[model samples]
Target: MYEYIKNPALIHEGPPRSATSMLSKPRVPLILVHDGGGTSFSYHLLDRINRPLYGIENAKLHDGGWWDGGVPEMAAHYVSLLGKILPEGGDILLGGWSMGGLLSLEMAHQIALAAREAKSRETGESSESSGTSTPKTPIFRVLGMIFIDSIFPLRLAELVGPLPEEPIILSGEHSRTMKLKDKVDLNMTHARMMVRFWQVPRWRWRDEAVPVPPTILMRAKEFVNRNPADDQSFVDYTRDLRLLGWDDYDEEHGHFIRDLWEVNGHHFSIFDHKYLDDVTKKVRKAADKLDPPEF
Candidate 1:
């Protein structure tokens, strides 16, 4: 369902590269999912990472439709697309910023599930018991995951309480201003709605059957202090930055390597030009851990 867009500049000494061609390279491709804005354009600002990089955006954005599903459904859609893109299957690095980060976790889980199912079918365990043919899905080995300033959904709720109720009626001037704001930034409006409506189902790494890949969590050094009077004070938020609410899972499982890097700037500003270089550097460093050491 996701169409591969061409980026001639990203092509290195080869024909104009498509998605499949990008994955066909010797190095495992790093796929970054779009943030809440439903577009991966922001990722283009990143400096060259010395690896094949692909950004996956919401197909609905191009088709003028809306994603009416939750995080799981969205992850499933991407996993299916990845299967088609690399039918032969190979290792890949998955990551994203904010909402994309949450989606990446789910995507990794789904990929592992598919691989397990595929293996079961191979030894006649699944088919013999179920009496139904298991549809073959491409198996992918996830090298690691990079989470950019992403807070777990449960933690997010504890930090910021319930969403404020929308006023039934607004003043004429205020209504006009709201409409203008939406027009000026339609993507933001859509993103806000998508996030507000969708529910994040409970997911835990320990509950999963497959082993989780090594994870690198790049947390913002500063917390956004927009609402000073809010119940959750800045101190409480900053104190939790050590793990970014992933402490429980990590403490329990200890199956994969977990590294946390604090990057300079607040959550949103981390993507700004002033701080983006540091972010890019950290990302590249985190990704490099999965690579074979140069002798």
Candidate 2:
């Protein structure tokens, strides 16, 4: 049980951390960028899975949007928000679930460009013309990525939808009010968003170009969509990700957060079939890989 609330403006609580400094000393912090849709309370649940096992802390950007800024001007605001989550002058691993994962990839690309510019300025060499490798001024020493039931590029329809008025969820204490009609509408909405974002430019993060950091991706098994439940069929989700330049997209793992070594699924899967244990166990194992420096 990670103690959490829906919004930061909650009643008579306590002080909040400045965006720049939410981490603790001697312990590395994980920037957990959660997806936008409903209230961010779900991340409170996500927080529980992380802090206990890793002995590290994490925080969610309330009402976060993956586009770039907020929901409206996401593309522009994305990098700056990324700066906030990154370790200030330190190597901080990036983790994203659902839409947050896609945004993390985009931000990594931006950081790469910034490094290029800084090198050019320092050495008085024109990076564009020189065509030589310049020193990398990392946005953060992004080590590895943890993907929880996400591959945004493949599922465009889910990302472009405007923030839902009411949070759309498959499993929640509040799911009692959810109706079949809403699920149908959401499916249609997801289709349009994916289609529209199709033409949007894609950014690739290469292991050769940057630090070649390691990566981790988790996919849901039993959890299928209602409409095109078989939509992800025949898709070697890992290969598609490899094309995107990530080092690994492991599917040999289980789903849910409370398992012994299973990779967690999408945000909704957190509430599916007592799966949280499975998700947590996998993430812990993936995280443990960093313990004695085993890549």
Candidate 3:
């Protein structure tokens, strides 16, 4: 029942001047999560990927960010959202760019929890919900997870140095916009949100309690800064995730079948191109590893 929202800007059959072979293929369904910027529309690159990319931007499901409602509650709501959109028995892979990636992992955590709970409560007797009998377990589960240029571990960004404190004040070169101090303040606010997310006592890592999912992490290849430590630190931060049992990740790998093409944008540019062939090939490859592909 997971229905994908189709955004043409996200899908690329190929740029106007290019090939048609790629355009003719079937589009795969992608469940995309967006980074916080009040706009999920930014992730339109999925249109070009081999599969159809589904963008689930900030959930109006829980207005004030899930931190206030509790990550577990928010996480469960998201998992349910995935369920509502997908066709029954459909296997969907989860992935996100930046903060989106982090949440995907969290979704994995939520599923793992539900799976565990269902197992624990399995009684021979039938169960009833709202006075109606139903199956004893949750139905939705992810086939895999992919992370793109994502952030890892709380308080990790500080090690990378502060993000731009405020919006560039100059609209052009002369007009002033946001102040520098404002930018810093915003970063601080975001930091507090992270702290709130991790407020789940003993819940810092997903694998701590939940079974980790098959994970695909594609770390940034280019350096974000002149500081060599920044690059190394980012790697180190994610490396810790491996200890949770995700070591097979491809840091800079893309499909060999399709010529590697970038969407020409920020870190999450994987979707920018109209190259559905690339995504088709990659998803097929990934599907082979996890489960059989849908026709």
Candidate 4:
């Protein structure tokens, strides 16, 4: 059973923020994003791993107030919620499956920015206190990002225009079971936001002025080339990943590394018990390679 952690920050204004599960004493907290259905149910099997883990539920599960924002906005909400749960200015390890992976990437990027701002503020405060300049260093670090069978959706705006007014079908069993109209509205909002999310440019270190952390991409072997569109999409996505420096790995020098692991079964089916052992093994191996927390 998943132990849900409530966010005290939202005790009165909105529904409490929820975590799918949490570890008592994690080496470093690993937070996973919710899949397309906007629930962390799909990642329930990952609880078997003996690591500090938390799965973020979709904001829509609470209210429809944040339904219209793009990836940046969603990531910002998570960054705030995570700050409340994680140690202040501590290292974070993040991963996601499918669209959740893309969201995780954006969240990591946003977290780094927030960390820099906080560092700058602290440095200025220290300099004022002692009347001496203090060199600023990063307070929080995103160790790495794990991508599971995720392809960045970069053409959503062009594909889905003006935020669909019609209700989208909630295909997942978890979503289909929801009775609240607002919850269904949340799903529609996410679908529309996803169409807008692709508008956010890929993280290019030089162009975007954002740090690209090391990434581990686990692919579903059977799903990559299911159709011509899938084949082309994979090619295009991987091409950008390489261009954005997701193909480099050098553990000895502590450089950002991007590695890929091919797992059995299709995208959705890969999380089943039959394949979870192999999946968890690869996830742990990738996470272990990330920079260890400072003592």
Report the Cα RMSD per candidate.
6.7, 10.8, 9.5, 8.7
TM-score of 1: 0.72
How high is each candidate's TM-score? 0.72, 0.51, 0.56, 0.67
113-200: candidate 2 lDDT, tens digit per residue: 5665665576676534666775443355555556565553544434343644433334443234556345334433432353244432
State how far residue 93 of model 1 sits from its true place (Å).
Answer: 0.3
Per-residue lDDT of candidate 1, residues 179-279 (tens digit)? 43242244334444445555543334345545677888888887566576856532236435477667766655563537888888877777899987898
Candidate 3 per-residue lDDT over residues 230-287, each given as its tens digit: 5454334543343211322222222211112222223434445544345445544553
| Candidate 1 vs candidate 2, TM-score winner | 1
Clashes of 1: 0
Candidate 2: clashing residue pairs, number: 25
Residue-level lDDT for 230 in candidate 4: 52
Summing lDDT over every window of 10 consecutive residues in candidate 1, give the lowest-scoring window: 7-16
lDDT of each: 0.65, 0.41, 0.46, 0.60
Question: Could you arrange the candidates by TM-score from highest to lowest?
Answer: 1, 4, 3, 2
Candidate 3: stretches off by over 4 Å: 1-29, 48-52, 60-66, 87-90, 119-138, 155-157, 160-192, 195-210, 226-295
In model 4, the Cα lDDT at residue 254 comes to 44
Better candidate by lDDT, 1 or 3: 1
